[model samples]
Target: MAETIVVDPITRIEGHLRIEAVLDNGVIRQASSSGTMVRGIEIILRGRDPRDAWAFAQRICGVCTLVHGIASVRSVEDALHYPIPANAQLIRNLMIAAQFVHDHVMHFYHLHALDWVDVVSALRADPQKTSELAQSLSSYPQSSPGYFKDVQAKLSRFVASGQLGIFANGYWGNPLYKLPPEANLMAVAHYLDALAWQREVVRLHTVFGGKNPHPNFVVGGTPSAISVGPSSQASNSGTALNMNGLAIVQDVIRKMQAFVEQVYLPDTLAIAGYYKDWFKKGEGVGNFLTYGEFPSEGKSIDDLSSLMIPRGIIVDRDLTKVQEVDLRAPEQIQEFVSHSWYDYSTGKNAGLHPFQGQTNLHYTGPKPPYEHLDSEQSYSWLKSPRWKNKVMEVGPLARVLMMYATGNKPARELVGMALSKLDLPTEALFSTMGRTAARTLESKLIVDEMQAWYDQLMANIRAGELETFNEALWEPSSWPAEATGVGFTEAPRGALAHWIVIKNGVIDNYQAVVPSTWNAGPRDTLGQDGPYEAALRGTELADPKQPLEILRTIHSFDPCLACAVHVTDPNGEELLQINVT
Candidate 1:
């Protein structure tokens, strides 16, 4: 008989997720991914002003807050045929790039690093050796022996106090952890450093958007104004993004670039060197997709001609040919809820495009705190998103592979350098470890490009082209009676697209196909597993009781279930409740 293992509320991720795996002789025979909450945010969007969608959508996930806002406003703009000024585009690029750097670093150090680093092991590490290891990795000035000793003492005190806090409930001392003591110490110290660094980097978002988390976004342009004069509205009011504020933004960008180069990149490579075997495992679906983001000059929202990140599909693990993604075609993208806790008006078995998508709850799994999920029944709240009805992996790996396959110069050079350092081939870029490293490389790529964007914006402003907002299509009278458009961008997690249908200036229907939805959705109507389930299949477990190996693969995609799904109950009553031992 095959045994079932359950990992509910996978700790440290943004939101709740339950993974059920069937093990046959210590190997995963099958896996199921479930989002235990319902995301009715789309329902909340109905009948609202199309321009206000960004505010509500941005609440989808606090961790990836700004991404939804960006996509939401872009959707409205696309629908209205509105075009923002060039400076607005560059500012948006800077904001999105800042998010990638901030979010990826946090995911690596705070969320995913613990999966590989044993906190207890760091206690046994010598502070001097830890400093030496850190110094060898990068020129990040915090690699002193005293710094490591201080971090170790803090860890020691936390352990002695018996309150591990965030460090609690981890699978410590698990045989699966491969990092040596010194490496563990170095990672832990940088983990703390990242906490401080993130605070400074997020100031970039505040300068542009007026605040962090859900930043303000207008359909035509950003809410920020350019101010060069002392009596300018922004200068007098001391609002962010003023002339003085622009200097601060430049400083933040410099800090972001420094940290990515010094700490994030080196740390990822150093730690990954210990678990190189992981480069061969956790390959899923063998299909990658990216909607393509970071537009350069001459790139329109609907076209991929000048996108810094190319948009295409690589299927069956073949990187030789890239397929073009057509979001407007009815048959191109569809969502299936066959294994999900929802019903479609047409039928549960039918696949619906975003313009015609529906969300109706119909939970049909074992009650909460149940021992195991019935894999044959509805299991998740996430709808399986398919491109041409094929399971696809997205996120950093997809972007990296797309750039590599297209012979992108910078991507090729960076990937080549990293692979040569690890003594691995291009094939190694297909696994779990590769996904994590790709995220690091992506941060560098985005940050390096930030300088050019900033320079362009400054030049445009100096040349008397300070326009940011485009009011040509701001009036409701300017739009057609009925219009539909899709806003697509590459979020930090992966490909994200939001579809909106507007009638009489009100949102008729809205559907967001988030990155996590692509990666963590349940099995589709055709019985094909999603990326999460596909990656879990055939994974070997060193200890069934402590499934660290399972987490390594799942977290590599940086699962954000909150962005994938969300919820509450009616009439002040809990739908289902259970106590687990």
Candidate 2:
């Protein structure tokens, strides 16, 4: 008999996720990934002003706050055929690049490192040996023996105090841990460094958008204006985009570059050396997709050739040929909710594109606090999203593969370097570890590119080009009676797109197929498993009780369920509530 194991409320992720796997003699025979919440943000956007979509859409996920805001404004701009100034385009590029670097560093060190680094073992590491190993990796400037000693002492005090704080509830002594105590101590030290580093880097968003999470965005262009003089209305008394502000932005970009080169990239290669075997496991749905982002020129969105991250699809692990994606094609992108807690007016088995998507809740699984889900019926809140009727994996791996396939120089160089360092072939870039390393390499690529963008913005400013917002399409009466558009971008996790329909300058319909929805969705109407389930199907668990292997693969995708589903109650009353300390 195949015994079932349930891991509900998977910890250290953004929102609630439950994984059910059937183990036959220590090997996973099958698996299911479920999102336990429902999101009605789309429903809330209906009948609202199109200009206000960015404000509401940004609230989709607290972690991925800025991506949604950018997508929302782009959707409205695409619908109205609004063309923003070149300076605005450059500023937007810089902000998005900062978000990628900041998010990837935080994800690797804070969110995903504990899975590989055993904090309990760090106390046993000799601080001198750890310093030697850290110095061998790169000149990070904080690799002194005293620094490691302080970090190890901090870990010891936490253990002795019986209050682990964020380190609580971790599987600290799992046998699968591969890094030496020295390596573990090094990772822990950088993890603390990243926390302070991210706080300073995010000021780029604050300088440009006036806030960090949920930054302000406009439909026509960015909300920021170039500061030419103190008398300019856009320039405030404290500090705006003035010369001092520009210098601060430049300094932030340099800091981001240094961290990726010294701390983030070198740490990934060193840790990857210890777990080369992981490069062969957790390969999910070889099909990859990216909507392409960061336009290199001030061109129309229709011109895919100018994008820094090329848009295309790779099927069945074939990289020789790239299939073009058409977001406007009705049959290209569709969502199916057969195994999800939702109904479509068309039919339960039908697939609807975002323009015609529906969100009618229909929960039929066992009620809350249950031991196991009845997998035969609706088992999750996430709908299965498919491209051309096939499961596709999206995120760093997808973008990196797309860049390599398209002959991108920077992507190829970085990937080639990382693979050479680990002594692995290109094929190794398809597994769980590859997914994590890809995020790091992509960060370096983006950080390098940021310098060119910043230089361009400065050149434009020196040339006296200060326009940022396009007010030509600000009037509601200027739009046609009905218009629809799709905004697509490559988020830190994967491809994110928002589709909107406008009637009389008001939103008639809105739908977002977030990156997490693509990776964490449930089975489709045909009973085919999504990426998360497919990845876990054949994984070998060393210890079924701990199941650390399961978390390794899932966290590689950086699952963000909060973006996929939201809370709702059809009975018009609070179903359940709890107070936490």
Candidate 3:
């Protein structure tokens, strides 16, 4: 008898996903990850000025929309070889940092916490005890006894308001939720605090991008002008000696720095201690990868004038045994459409870059046509991406290992400190739990760097390096008529890259190999499963109908929509295509 488990419309995260697991005994034998809703943004981008692509791409995802804007601009810049000033680099970094802080905090509390902390359990919490715990954790914000009572009262009111839309049909009261009622109450209180903090960080983007959800950044530099005297030309001039504008952004970053160190990091550690089992379970793809990030001052990883973290791949039984990366090598990356709706030549060995990409949806039945394919193609619109012609994992696990191997001293030291805090031996960094811990650890490192960068900007400003912006775009002819460039950056989840081909001032071809394409991919031609697919095979299902364990494991990676992946239904009314710039 095949055991069947179903999770209808998974809650707490963006978009829609439904999981149906076919089980043999207590283990998942087959799993289906369904993409539940349709949002047509790509179809919307067609026939518009490629210049407006970033603006529309940003709307594809509200949480990481800035990344889309950044990627879009980078793609254009790549096509043009537009050189951005030092000030522009600093400004872009600041915007990305703000998004990182905002996304991580909201993800932890608003989305993932309800799975671990029982909301209904909070009703039994003692307000006095909660206050005492808060006081004990000095890293957290100070609150008086009455403040704790007020927080509890507000939570009660909010709950009674019947506005638990985010928490609707949550996994509350599940036995898997292990935190005590007091702990749950404390977390619930922090959830509210996180909401406010997230809003504050979002301002960092507003100051730079003009709006949240999607901000505007120019190809040559930022849209905002640096204030230096009355003339607009002076605003775009480099700060050869002045340092005023850099200081403004630097100060804002400092505020965020203090919050993460004194609040966010400590909070994650505290929460992790209560959920120690996560360290052992849900470990997928021990091999790690990073496309490098945040270029160091004066160094270019791939010959790009801008600073980049570095790019490399590591596969070893031991974490320390990892090696350097070679992104230039062909055959390292491949895309499989065997089970997808697309029509492609079978077993063809060729580079299928995004510009030469193909996405033609076909449906023969619920079951895919290929013999190696799934019995039911009832799920996601995302196609599986593989490395070295095989499915490989991506994200924190990949980033942590890469950072540990090729990153600066600070990144390495931060990883070391995280391992120590978890009480696992230093070598334990090689496990699944280490991946989760690495993200929290790596975030701290990024936060610290952001603060220092801010201080550097301010110091330069105080030295009279203040300017509003750069005007590299003034001479459009400076750009080549035909060019190809790759824009790669570290999104909050993992490595993200965009490749663009430009001809006659328009995007001849554009492609994005998103983080999800690597982590959530399906099986390849060789019959090997992707990271998410492999991870699901070993998970024990208590009830096939409600597999919380599987959901918890897969969601840890936090999959985002891939712009290049699309499903088409010829019979449907006009094929839901989105276009907004």
Candidate 4:
């Protein structure tokens, strides 16, 4: 007999996620992932200006703030064949790169670190030993014994109050956590350091986009104009894109690169030295997908060759040949609702492409506040997004593998180095720890290339190329009666795209296939489990109650259910619908 272990509302993630793992003989026999909420940004976009969609769509998830704007604006641009200025493309690249570095660091340290590091165990670590461990790893500035002592003292206070604060609700004494006390203390200290590091680095977004966390964006290009003058537009507010802002942006990139090299990358490798078993677990559908991201300045988006990260499909762990991906092909990508809480006109078993995508809400799963979700039927709010009718994993692992398969020298060197350091084979890249390690590897690769992008921008400014926005397709009079487009970006989590149907200058239909929807969605019509479910299969539990092993694998993908799936009551009644004027 198998017993189902339900972990409702998986903590430290972006949105509502419930994991139901059926355990037999202390091993996971089957797993079903459920996104407990749904979002209607697609429905809200209908009948609105396509240009204004980014404003509403950007609110899809605060953590993935500027990405939606990038995808939305690009979808409209793709539809209209709109071309932006070279400098605008450079700025967008820089901003997107920053988002990746920032989001990845935050996810690893804050959201996923506790799964490995025990804060309660950190209190028992000797400060001197911790300082030595940190020094052996990287030349990070905060590795002094006194610094570790102070951090431990601070952590002690959190425990002393019978409240661990952010470190609360953790299975602190779980046997699955293998990191020694010294390593745990080192990780805890760096976790605090990353918190401060992120605070200053996000100013890069403010410098380029005029604000962080849902930065202002324009359809044609960036919103800010390059102003060398002191009295430029918004100069009084310090939001002007002037020499001062440019200098700050430069400094931010340098600081970001330094942190990744010194703290984030080394920390991951050091902590990973203890948990080698994880490299064998959490391997889900060997097939991977990527939209390919980070284009060069002045390069057209149509030129896939210009992308630093090559986009392609790796089917069944075959790294020898990378398959080409076409977003416009209707048969290549489609969404199914067979096991999700939505409906299609063609019926529950049919799949619909984004151009013909619909967002008709329907709930057939057990009502909320219930014990178990009947996985035999609709069990999740997320629609299963499949590429060529095949399940694929997305995110850092896919992107890294894409880069490696495409023969990117830097990625290859980094991947080889990480493998050598871990004493693991290439096959290990498919595991739970592999997904987490790929993130750090790609972050360093992207940051290493950031200097050139900054230098090019400075050269462009010197050459008097100051335009950011293009006005060719700015007005409705210049637009066609009907047009359709797709915009994509390799978001921090994975490949994210927004599709739009523009009619008479207004959005007629819209669909967004977020990364989480591809990963966290329930089973498809073929009865194949999503990445979350597939990864959980075969994972054994030490203590069924604690289930720390489950958290380790799931957190590797860094679930963002808020962006993946929705909103509504279980009774089929709209609880709240505010019409935005």
Candidate 5:
């Protein structure tokens, strides 16, 4: 007999998640991943000033807010045909890299590590040994035994200080998770260390953005004034020689690069040895996709000479031969709301781009929709995005594959080194484990690249390359009567696309195809699973009550449901409703 098992209120990650599994005795049958809460962000965005959308959109996810801000501005810039300054491009890339470091460190240590390591186990760790480990890994004076003792002392104080907010609802003593006491202690110490490191690195965003989490960024150009003298405002005209703050910014970048190399990278490798089993599981959706990122050079999409991050698509696990990515190319990309509550405008097919979307409501049973792609038939608010109408992977794994396929020397070298060190086959880089490992490896490369960009900025500054324009002189009356534009950017998750239509200087209509929408959408009208869905199929569930493997695999993608990212509590007590038979 088959019975349903549910693990609700999944912990230690962003937002909430519910995992429902079907089991026959000890064997698994099927699984359903659910996001149980809803807050209408789209409804909130409607009728608001198009200019203010960035402010609200950034708040959609506390983790990757700056990414959303950039995506939003890129959309508006597309509509306005605005050209950003070269220096602005470099600054944005640097900010993005800082966020990458901040996010990855936080995710690995605080969020994901908690699932693998026991915080309480840290109390028994030998502080002197940990300091020795740190020092042996790097020649830094800060990694001495005394340093780890202070770190342990701080952790104790943190728990006693009523500031265990980050550890609320944590399950450190759970028998289901297997973690060595020593490893646990090290992770706990690093957790505090990372929190401090992330805060310092995140300031890069504040330098350019004026703040972190959500900063004021304009589409055409930055809302900043540069000054060469005592004030940066004078440099707004692009001719000022304000090298004061820029030097400080570059120095910080150098420091961060050192930390990622000497600290975070080593930590990841050391921890990987403890959980070598992960190398065998969590591989999903081999095909990867990336919309070229970091546009600075005058290069076209096909010619990435000018862009800091190149845009392209990869398939068949081949990243070498990239094809031009055109949203209007064909009907390859489609959306299915059948399983969802949304009323499908088309009964027979997935919604096509530009005109395709969902916003209707239907109350089906509480169970997930396994048949139709319509939201009315589905359980998730996220719409499934498909490439060539098939689920394709997107994330660091995909990005790295695409980069390597394009012969990115730095990424290739790092990936090769990681694979070799892990004692895994090089071919394994194309699997689920590859995707997770790729994220960490790519981060190391980006850390170095950020420093490279900093050096480039120094060269340009010395060579008299400066920003001459600050404010955009706008005449509302002279604004176009009607216009349409497409904005594409490489978000931290993957490629994000937004299309906007404006009339009389006001947004007539707006639509966004978020990264999670692509990674976690319901089936399209054709009954095709999105990337996450396809990856979920065939995954083993040893215990229905606690399917840690599946959760790790899914969360490995780092999904952020921009529309609604909440997961609800199952409340333990089951409610039974009787009906007349």
Candidate 6:
């Protein structure tokens, strides 16, 4: 049997993944990605009110909290031809932008950074030298020698405690780790700093949506009203978003922009400099997909043209040409369950559009305590989704490439700056390290734009336009008998879309083709490998017992197993369990 590796997410463990790799002469010859759990949220959504869909759908992935809700509400609004107020659009933009910045930064410092940084190595670093190195990169305030000493001390205590926890001193002597002791210590300090910084940044969500980790979202517009102007009620009086709340949001945006500019962007480039060889490997299937998001003022949610991140597709790593993406067209987007634990009314080989997607459970693998999954048959729970019969990669890499190909001036400039700073060519953007770099560059671009979104929202308040919810479609009695629509967003992880079919004011069918599923799915009917499988094929594992290289490439894609493999039974019974022997 080939070696089976179970990779768990940093935040959660139950919803994890397994990978089977065939090695030939120290290099991976083939790979398979298996989402161990199955998602049944779509099955649960059937026969529910379309307007209440966001509340339940938002629970799909606790980490990617707001995007699902946003997509769910927009899907219903699209089916009902709902148009929200301009102020509402700006608020949603701010909320979504906050989600992006928050998600990316946390992923970088907490999850992916450890793959390249060795925390145990930090114990050998000189605090003064680490401080000097940090000062040379960016003028972040916590670059003092004393600050480094304090961080090193805390990290040392954590390691010596013998209860390392998640930030444990893992892989102490791994040879593949390229960063120096000073660099590692600097990264470790920043990781702890980000943990504290994230607390304040999330206040933006609380100020706008009442809570985080699934903030409130309505189909037509925002859940809160504007309580602006001095003559009106004070801030936080009832459900109105007053000036005080906006001020808090503005402060959070400033903090986010500052952190990205000083910590996240510099740290990424610094780490990439030491691991330049990674740029030559880990390229996925040369196709990219992005569903545009953050529509400008007075623009429809379905309109991709005016989006901050334009919707488009890039094939064969070609930056010169970008094809249009039509989500609603049946031929444009499809999901196949050929190698997944699911059944379709049509044959397994048939690819169905999201509007007609199903969630039938059918596990066809070895029982628990098995050595490995049979790669030739059904393995993963995620169904393979394709665009025009072409396998595509979705996420930060795709978003950056699409923005660059479509000639978005800021995206182009940021990509150029990152490449030039790293002294790498444009073609390097397709590699595993390049994928990680693209994530950082996009974070910088998104954080810089947050100020403008906030400014516009405040400007609308000054103009006395305080309406948030659209009363036009609040009542289900004004609904059509049957309708279908697709709502999409360039989520922090990748392109995410929620498809809804409404009949008699209730959801007849609902499907979410999330980012993780697009990038972490299994092989299709034609025997074509999915993005994760294709990217892992040529990976040269330094040590079979400790395949840190595989983890590096997988983390570059930032796999969210929960998003890909979700679950719940019709009768709330435990569906399946696998015990590793």
- Listing every candidate in turn, what is its Cα RMSD in Å to the true structure after a full C-alpha superposition? 1.8, 1.9, 4.8, 3.1, 5.5, 2.1
Q: What TM-score would each prediction reach against the true structure?
A: 0.97, 0.97, 0.86, 0.97, 0.85, 0.96
Off by over 4 Å in 2: 230-240, 297-300, 362-369, 574-581
Model 3 regions more than 4 Å off: 36-50, 158-166, 229-251, 298-308, 316-318, 321-330, 345-351, 361-379, 426-433, 462-481, 543-545, 562-581
What would you estimate as the lDDT of candidate 1? 0.88
Native-to-model Cα distance after best TM-score fit, residue 504 in candidate 5, in Å: 3.3
List candidate 4 stretches off by more than 4 Å: 230-239, 362-369, 566-581
* Predicted candidate 2 versus true structure: per-residue lDDT over 213-296, tens digit per residue: 888888888877777775455456443477767888999999999999999999998888888999999998899999998888
How far does residue 424 in candidate 6 sit from its true spot (Å)? Answer: 0.6
lDDT of 5: 0.63
User: Against the unseen true structure, what C-alpha lDDT does each candidate score?
Assistant: 0.88, 0.88, 0.62, 0.90, 0.63, 0.84
Clashes in candidate 2: how many? 2
457-515 per-residue lDDT for model 6 (tens digits): 78877888788888987888888899998778878889998999999988898999999
Per-residue alpha-carbon lDDT of model 3 for 1-581, expressed as tens digits?
Answer: 66666665566656655556677778877665544344444445544555677777666677686887777777666666566766667777777867766677677677666656777678778888877776776555544556666766776775798876455566667777777777777787778777877766676666676677687777666776555454455556543212343444556677677767766676677777777767766666555666766765412223532443556667743545544444324455556665444454433223354545544434444432222224334334566666566455667667666666654577678767665776766556544445556666666777777865566555555577655355665454655677766677777777777666666666665556677767765555565566666666667766554567876776677666443245556565453332222
- The candidate maximizing lDDT is 4
Off by over 4 Å in 1: 231-234, 238-240, 297-299, 362-370, 566-573, 578-581
lDDT of 1 by residue, 511-543 (tens): 999999999999998899999999999999999
Candidate 6, pairs of clashing residues: 38-566, 39-566
lDDT score for residue 252 of model 6: 97
lDDT (10s digit) by residue, model 5, range 35-66? 54443444455555566767776777777768
lDDT of 4 by residue, 188-263 (tens): 9989999999999899889888788998999898987888666455486455588888999889999998899999
Backbone clashes for every candidate come to 1, 2, 27, 4, 39, 2
Lowest lDDT 10-mer window, candidate 2? Answer: 572-581
Deviation in Å, model 5, residue 164 alpha carbon: 7.0
Question: Which stretches of candidate 6 lie above 4 Å from their native place?
Answer: 1-14, 229-232, 362-369, 566-581
Q: How far is candidate 3 from the true structure (C-alpha RMSD, Å)?
A: 4.8
